[model samples]
Target: MGVRGLTTFVKNPSYTHDGSTTLLRPHQLSNTPVVIDGKGLLQWLYFENDVDCKHGGDYREYETICTEFIEALHQRGVKPFILFDGASNPDDSKVDTLLGRCRERIQDSAKIIDGDPESPKLRPPFTTAVFLKVLESKEVGYVFCDFEADSEIVALANIMGCPVIGNDSDFFVFDLTGGYIPLSSLRWKEARQLSIPCEKYSLDHFCQAYSMRREMVPLLAILLGNDYVSRETFDDLYHRVIKRSGNIPNGPNVRIPRTIRFLQSRQNFADGAKRLLKDEARRQGKEECIEKSLQAYHIAPESRYQAYLQQDPSMVDIPDCPLPAAYVDLYRRGAFPADYINLKFRNNRKKLLPNLVEDYIRPSCHLISQRIREAIYGILLHGLHDRAVQETGREGQDIKVFIVTGMPSLPEFGSLPNLERMIDLEEERRKVLVMEVLEVDHGRVQAIRDDLKLPVATTIYWRSKLDLPVTESGHHLMRVILLGIAICYSREDLNMDDVKGNLKEAPRVMNRTAVQAFAEWQSCMYYTMHLNTLVNRPYPTPDATKLYHGTLLHRIYATTRLQRDVNPDWVETDVLRGSPAALALFRHLDGVAQNQ
Candidate 1:
């Protein structure tokens, strides 16, 4: 979707990273806003749960994704600026195609829902009105782009000298040089701050990787097609006006390299497109092909930019990268050219531009990956706060003990002998948190829970649902153990005596899908913890399979997080909010099966 065939053609993805997988602390930078993509965040929220909102969810359903994410950033000392795309698409040509794809996905969703338990469920993309309203409710800063938010976000990131946080790889095509973060990498896994580098890829590295001039990349994208334009459509446009001199055999992906060669020849797009068309026509004996190819060229890139910008002019007035509506005119008038090759030598730089011919991806590029590693730990309650306080001492309170379960025992399904090595691997990097995995596994959850003498604040970082289909008894047992600890300390905030007596009065929770039910579970947990009435909540009831799900882990931690609240006794809902599992954590398939 980025530059259709670009990622594959390049062979080498430009990136840099430190060998360490430990989470990074967010540094407070003045005048730098962490740009967020609203639609991307919505998907993260929807998928993080067992929720099935594919038929499309309403405002009340998805509002928490915004509220929780904003607060998470604030807590880490980041000023997040949100961006949403408007309902207008300047190019109407794509609606039918986009709708077609959406319909296909919706059909798939229906099959998944009505068919097998293992069928993959997909949510359909919808308008942003509901998400925008939530942003307004919280009084957060945001802007609706005229067409799409990709270019706007990149422009803003460059203007602010900050980082763009999103999942879209198209930012690579935009030449987002200053900074970029995939939104999925910012989720809360182990309660760590999201740390990503300021620069994802520079122009130099991109050119080197693709083995072509900079201008050719976008041209290749036009030929290969991107989100706005389909590759088949672009090919059709090219085939319509062309005369075949001889019916040459079409080999595998021969056009991609040929297009790259054609684009690279002229150094400038306008000159190159005309020249390529001319070259083709001379060989085919149809001189008219050049004119037809040029016409097709004008529709894309600029019109792609225009259709998006004219829908909303206020986009240009953004505080960070305020460009007037005139730029779109400039774009259309052919004032702007994708001339990376010529500009490199013409103006000239003292040094050749950046390229990663090195083994390590530059540390700057992998900042989000490292940050995501830590976030997953925190979100998963892998003693993230405990570790953060040890390193930063910002959180006044910390965990005295960890009740971690689901340590990797079997190596055959592909867990390794080195628990320490798990942190080095990408899959376990998000889920596994251990100084030494073997030591933790040896300690055992029951042993730790039974020992009970070593702690004031305790937490669970168990891989329950991921490990097994949890039963009702399992949930009750986990609740009893944690509540027993609370009762032991006589944590008056939980109203131990009162909640113990009122536990029976807590209503039965049902009548909702797993996603909605989990949301309610999270919401209730937040309220209960914010109100300091954890004990008043019902005892955990394990459903044989449902209780085994890790969704309840979020519920439990939301309640426990109040212990770190500035005023644990007072209602501070601001600090207790929803989480983005996509950003902060990742899971491994190795130990997730029935036996695991």
Candidate 2:
């Protein structure tokens, strides 16, 4: 959703020295609405706030950050519309780019484990889920686009006449009336104190500054290349039009300024487009690529996204595969996970986010969550028997792809319920179905709190699948899970502040084994959360603060290694004090694990 070098290009002194970019303030936007890039904001918020991406993410801290951010915007009277990017459409030509990013994330995860916290904040598995949870809690307006959110984000912003808040360079090409506000230049926090300096960029101002027709912007984007057409594809065109300057260093950085100057000399987009595609024999192919990329810049007066944001019932159709109305409604509302959509379109169930777990390891970390996902697939794709959802995970230093078709052959419990009526099922029936899918013994979580049942079920499955030896790290993982469940279910009995404080320690370097174990646990929880959403959320989702604090878990694991047994004493002042219910749950899980 970005033009590779456009972000850096716009920030250059040559471009900004003109009136193209101007400082904006919140007070100046009292009634002004803005559409934010949810996907971009997700990455930006997590990384910028220094949430512990190294040892898994600090979701509790992240939740707070998102909440405060939204609240700040609200205080300034900014009507914010957040838009999230969905999976790529079938004809998406960016597969190589997507796969390249996947590889990069995997490698970066390893760097983080090797004691480098500065790696590209490899997104944690449940970041989107957590972010959406915050959005709903705050009653914010948001919708997941049909495919890439760029065009739709622009479409919506154009309709509302509001600036688009994002870091994507595509905004530079779109002729938006409200212009674009890069998150990097936003001073929302400072705006609360006073009208702090912030920047807004408009295509009009840019065109005027460069003395180029506005139509040339899209052509300029194509000439520079984008996701649809690689910059290498237009190398011949760039060489023909752009002259070299010794003052500017060579690379993608210099391509923008030189290309813009050249584009300014052109009178019309048609003439520029013709010359750009006038290479040798493959002119037709180059022309088609240019048209395809150009089509992305065309914004319709009205978009299907409007209906979606309005929560209209008519906005629930997938291209070929027809999902139930109820499921579609949930999917649109952001209640349903995007994996279902990905399954229908690409037959690809996204792999869990990469971690320190070695790709060469047998029975990859994803194996721990395979059973849960199978149940999810069985329920979602029950009638579509011929379709197989592929689990794309790491396998021996390569991205492993495998088909999940074992659910149909497994021991029969109950026929897959009709998804349309699944949400309306009796609470006990829903509980039974959820437990059966999770493969948890009904008796184990029968007496547990209603909110704890689903987590306990997943916790049981996690332990059975893990089958780890008696090790301090293994026990620490179990204790952390049990403690999280206890905290969520018994917030009143225990001192919540004390509990958070106890686990509040800086992240330390963890061995690969510890990282792998936690990664597996996270995978288990993530898939179970998806299944939980599918079955109408029988229990409350575990609070991130209570369940998974990266720093706290690392601290607890380190403490466990120094002692023979894990005790509340390992941490300070009875982290488990006045929480017999939590203790009982831990005992039950430990007992189940021991017997297994």
The 0-to-1 C-alpha lDDT of every candidate, in the order given, reads 0.36, 0.68
Candidate number of the best TM-score: 2
- The Cα RMSD of model 2 versus the native structure comes to 3.8
> Which residue pairs overlap in candidate 2's backbone?
none
Runs in model 2 deviating more than 4 A are: 13-28, 193-197, 240-252, 269-275, 278-289, 307-321, 345-363, 396-398, 414-427, 467-476, 487-507, 568-573, 578-596
Q: How accurate is candidate 1 locally (lDDT)?
A: 0.36
Q: Which candidate number has the best lDDT?
A: 2
Residue-wise lDDT of candidate 1 within 1-596, one digit each (tens)? 24565444333322212222211223323234666776676666666654533222332334456566556666656766666553223333344455455445434443443444554545422213345445556655665554456666666666566676765555555555454555444544334554322324444555554455655455556556555445554454355532121233466545555554444444555565656544644565544433432233231222122333334333243222222344322222222111111111122111111111011211211121222223222322222223221111001111111122222222322332221232234533311222122112322332222223111011122213112122222333234233333332233334434433322321122112322223222222222121111111111211111112222232333343334221222212222112122111111111111122
The segments of candidate 1 whose C-alpha lies over 4 angstroms from its true place after superposition are 5-31, 48-50, 54-65, 116-130, 191-199, 233-270, 274-596
The lowest-lDDT stretch of 10 consecutive residues in candidate 2 is 21-30
Candidate 2 per-residue lDDT over residues 1-596, each given as its tens digit: 56777777677625433554432323244457889999899778887888877777778788888888887778777878888876565564666567667677667765666676465667777777778888889888888766788888888999988889897889988988898888888766666442323577888877767777777888778767787777777676566646552234565466777777666655555674556554521554655566667788888887667776665667777566566777676676666766577665466544334443332344577778888878788777666766466666666556667777525423545676646677678867766777777777666776655666666677777866674555544555676656555555556677767776665354465656656777788888878887877777767876555567666656556555556345644432466666776666656655554444
